[model samples]
Every structure is written in structure tokens, then in C-alpha cells.
Target: MSLPDFSGTTPQERLASLRRSVAGRIVFTTSFGLEDQAITHMIREGGHDIEIVTLDTGRLYSETHAVWAETEQRYGLRIRSFHPDPQALAALLDDWGANGFYHTKDARLACCGVRKVEPLKRALAGAEAWVTGLRADQSQARGDVMAIEFDTGRGLAKAAPLHDWSREDVARFCETNGVPVNALHAQGYPSIGCEPCTRAVKPGEPERAGRWWWEQDDAKECGLHVDADGKFVRAKEAVQ
Candidate 1:
């Protein structure tokens, strides 16, 4: 696939350029974080055809839901939500109690897989490109983010337009564009995920220090960005 032009005078221009250049359908998954909110603004203002969706892990914070409602109200755009299959959710609950994930890393990953990864697969179905708000500074596990890459396992092009932008840059963009964002970020939760698996980090902590924080430092990520072949974008050397 030919690489789309990811450069522009502004983030909105870059995203609009992507929409024009990329072939087939494009899906943008937002977690209602600052970075995602910035991208949502670009998509809405530019009136791009990208489908905006989110994975409802069912354990998200109430503030997250509030922001989601606000965004839809502001944009008049219905952000599609992908939920875990009821049967699959039930089976997971039956096997592991609601909070079982806290006890072991395996359990946590299992929960993430059932709640996030599966739903994400459904969300990406029939999509030619998958766009995310991933930034290089979010965490060491994601520190090597690229603007474009071929997700071989999913047979789709993945683009992270804001990969080079810092967290402060995203926040400034949101403020300048009036994009709705989750309120949890102000409470020291720079990287917000499921309520059960997330917390507010202490001073000087990395953005993602709160996500799955109990596990070993290297044991980051919830399998959402992990490929089916056990390879991760951050861990592998850049292909291009």
C-alpha cells in the first residue's frame, strides 16, 4: 500500500489529507482521551468519512461515558460503540470473578482480551485502515509509534497521525478546538482505560503508569495493540 501523506500545517489538515489519500474505509477508535479528542475534532471539522468508534469495556469510568455523550451532542455524530459479546462476557465472568484480573497478570490479560481485543476485531472488520490516537510519548511500550504501518495480522493499514505529538500538544489542540475529553485526565490519570484496571498516577509518573500499574513495569499494555503473532510495534525495529 502506498503511504498516505501524514504531513500538514495542522493536525486537522493531516487527517483530512489521510481521508483523501487512503483507499477504502477508515476506522478511528477513540478512548475519549485528550489525544483521541483532538483527532475527533479533526474528523468532525473536516467532515471526513472515517467511522469513529470506541470499545465499551463495560468497566469504564462514569466520567468517560459523560465525555462520550458530550462529544456526540457537540458533533451531532453518533459514535458507534463495540461491546464484548454477551456470551463471551458471561463466560469470562463465570470463570473469573469480576475483580479476578487484579490478582494475576494472566487474568488481567484475559479480561482485556475478552473485553477489548475481541470487540476491537469486530470494530475493524471490513475496514481498510485503522486509525488510533497513539503517541510516541505515551509509554515505553508505545514509544516507537510510526505515522503509518501495515498491520499484517489484520491485513490493514494502521495510522497514528499524532505519533510525534506530545501530550501537552494534544491538550493544547483540544483546548483550541473545543474537543470534549474525559475529565479523569485532570485527576492525574493521563492515560485512562477501564476503571477497574486503571488509577491515577503519582507525581512525575509516566502517562500510562496508571494502567495495569500493579504488574511489573515491563508488563504494560492490555493486548489491544498487540498483534496476533505476539509481535508489538514498539518492541520490533521499525520496518520503514
Candidate 2:
């Protein structure tokens, strides 16, 4: 499917055009964060036909759940949820304790694979295009992200409506439009993922510093996004 040239259009215009072009083949994944909330508002309030989904890692914060419910109520939309395969999750837990991810990078990635990446693959299976709330300023890994690009990892066209929006811009939009957002964001958690792996960022730290704080490396992504090498690599043996 050929996408319309979104070069000179606003984000809302681009999103509307993408929805019309892709129709039912488009899906949006949200983590209920501030940015995602803004995009959700745009999609829902704009009456776009795009389907919205989320990963339920079972390790999410209560605040995240609260926002999810609130979003549904506010927009009167049902956000589909995807979860890890039970057998795989049980096998992973049996091999490594519940918190095994704290031990090594491989273990952490394995957990992420079962709880996030794998489920995401299923969620995106029939999608021709997927939408994200990613912004270039969020992390070094995403510094080069464009508004629209083909996601080689998922083999689909990925759209980031908020790609150029700033943190302050997102905050102002949410406040001005009354968008539902995670409560954790107010308590210093600029980025919220699974509850155990994420924490609040300290002063002088990057917004994404709160996610996977133990890792000394700067590649803090959970394999949902492409890596610096432009590969969708994840922990070995995660699929089996």
C-alpha cells in the first residue's frame, strides 16, 4: 500500500490520512504514558478507526492500570490487550526466579521477550501499519527516528505522530486537552514500564533513565523498538 506524502501536513492530518489509507489494517500500541496518552486522545477523539492495543506484562504499576481504565472511560473505547504465553512464562520462571532479570542482561532480555516482545509480535501480526508515541528527544537510541518509516523489525509501516514533540509539549497538550495520563509520571517516573524494572529518574538524569535502571549501557530499549544496529535482536532461546 502506498502511503500519502505527509511532508507538509500536521501530525493530525498525517494520522487521518494514514487511517484512511490503511483502514482496518492499522493498529496503535500504547503504554499509557504521557506521550501515548496524547496520541490515544488524537486517535479516539478524532474518531479514527485505528485499533488500539497494549501489552499487559503483569508487572505493571497500579497507576498504569488506573490510567488504562480511565482512558477507556474517557474515550469510550476498548483498548485490546496482549499477554505473554502462559507456558513460556512459567518455564522462564521455573528456570530463573521471578526477579532473574536483575541478574544479567540476557536474563532481563529474556523476561522482556516473554512479557513484551513476543506478545507484541502477536499483536502486530495482521497489521499493515502500527503507530507509536516515540519522540526523538526521549533517548539516544531514538534520536534518529522519523515521523514515518517502515519498521523492518515488525515488517510494517510505523508511524510516530509525536516524533517531533518535546516533553514539555506533551505535558502541555495533556493538560490543555484533559488527556488521561499515568499518575506515576507526576512522582518522577518520566518513563514507566514494568513496575519492578522501572523507577523514577533523579535530577540531571534523562527521561528514560528510569527504565531498566540497572543496565550500565545506554541501549535501554525492550526489543520492541529497533536497536542502534537496526536489528530486532532479542534474548536467545526466547522464541523456543
RMSD (CA, Å), each prediction: 2.1, 5.2
Give the runs in model 1 whose Cα sits over 4 Å from its true position.
5-9, 229-231, 234-240
In terms of lDDT, model 2 sits at: 0.84
**Per-model CA lDDT versus the true structure:** 0.84, 0.84
Instruction: Give per-residue CA lDDT, model 2, range 1-240, as digits (tens).
Output: 454344424567778877776745888999999999999998877788888999999999999999999999999988999999999999989988899999998889889989998999999998898889988899887777677777656667788788788999999999999998898988999999999999999999999998889999886788888654635333221100
Per residue, candidate 1 scores C-alpha lDDT tens digits across 1-240 of 555566665667667877888878999999998888888888888889999999999999999999999999999989999999999999888988889998987788789989999999999999988889988888777877887777767777788888889998988888887788888988899989999888999998888888888887563877878866444654222222
Judge candidate 1 at residue 74 and give its lDDT: 96
Per-prediction TM-score:
0.93, 0.92
Model 1 vs. true fold: TM: 0.93
Residue 103's lDDT in candidate 1 = 91
Clashing pairs in 2: none
Question: How many clashes show up per model?
Answer: 0, 0
